[model samples]
Target: MGYIAPESPISDYDRDVVFFEGDLEELDFEVLQKGMELGFILEQRQTKTGDIEWVARDVRKFVAPPEKKVIPIPTSTKSKANPESPVNIYPSSYRTFLEKLSDSLKSIEKINDSGNFEDAVFSLLRLLGIHSVYQYSRDAQAGKADGFFILENLAVMYDCTLRNPFEEYKKDQIENYIHKLSNKSQLTIETRKADGGRGSKTLQIQGKSRQVWIITKGNTRELLVYDSIKVKEVAIKDLITITIEHCRELSYDAEHLSSKLVMLGD
Candidate 1:
């Protein structure tokens, strides 16, 4: 990831900033290249007093990579003797990652059987390359959502339930979940002052609205209501498939993969 400081005079910025110092001179070419390969860029710090400073931001936030280059379609093999050989469209590392993830997801039944669905799901998400995921939870007394995961500026709030009692989930339940997640919370971030120094800024986690999703092994239509709220539902196996197929895709674009969701329903 890379970030660019806004183009403005240092005199107009807020003062009283604090930030961690790092040495760029110590980095080798391989280290820098690896960082770039992982979709990161070095961002110049906005401090007025320091020499040119740089920080890292997630590349996906600022850069739009060409789809064809990032996700090529599978091509047929020329050799007939081994026609069954898999065609890898993405990088070898990504392919291997997906393979391992698929293997783990293939055992979802066993995972649930051992009463480890939540842990297994969390592990699967991490394996599928979702960074900074929180374990699933619901605090009715505290009024918090079941769970949430972040992707840049977006937060996806979700609830998980088993297949048998899916019909018991209602619109009011979904509303409560959304309401709980939308509550206010504060986060501290580094800011630059006009005098070339830094300060901390406290911002609310409720800055942006979140998307809602439901994970289950049951029918999604059961949650349909008369109200106009939109929700996405996915069966466990379908979630695994979607995660593997578009693991690199941002959570914001998940709706585009709806065609695959129907197939999983079959």
Candidate 2:
């Protein structure tokens, strides 16, 4: 290893020449020997202090690399859900949950849709260890939340309903429900905080959470709304498709399986 720089002021005539100044080690010798074919001329010089220093002159002319073009990323504009979107396929720890979700959805379809739908949803949430309470208290705005659940410090207030044809009226109703829930949740948090700092202790994170609006249908398409706005259309045709798609999204540590060929000689 040695110091490399222009031998002198980089003039037009000597622009290609670069100088290396220092003692050359074994590593330096190996590197110089390998690069000898690259037109790098190596020589030795004695300094005034009686020390030997290596000199390497690069004969190749330097050329700058081409500048890369800047590409701008397109922003999202509430893109419609695509059922044909690619999903990852791999082994996951949540494989059992995916199976159970698939089985539950199928079983619910076989039973009475209107009567058993809410119960089934609640059961599924319970299985996921999400504690739910029905008909929770609303704020002063009379925004009625269908249900409430506590996830760690996140107070999730949700509205569960069965909508047919998925019209604007249903959307408005859900929006109203979310408004009420948000107001109540905020008020509750403030009250808890005022009461000897109990609120801060209970809800470690203090903020309005996104409203979960689960809109189920017997024949029409299924939808999952957040804060009264439609997010996922559940556009897939069957439960297996939905399960696989959702599971793929949920799976972060996906493993890709591959096979390799080997050759042997006698």
Among all candidates shown, the one with the greatest TM-score = 1
For candidate 1, give the lDDT of residue 179. 56
Residue lDDT tens for model 2, 55-145: 5654333334455444333334322575334333333436677777667556754444533555554544454334333333223323354
Error of 2 at 80 (Å): 53
Candidate 2 global CA lDDT score: 0.40
Candidate 1 residue-wise lDDT, 1-266, digit = tens: 22224223233233322222242233333344322323333333545785444444433222444353433334553447765565455445666776886786777745544236755666666655456456432223133333555554555555665546643544566777555454446433343334546555454555543456677665444243223223556567766776776655422232243334333323
lDDT of 1: 0.48
lDDT of 2 at 243: 37
Index of the highest-lDDT prediction = 1
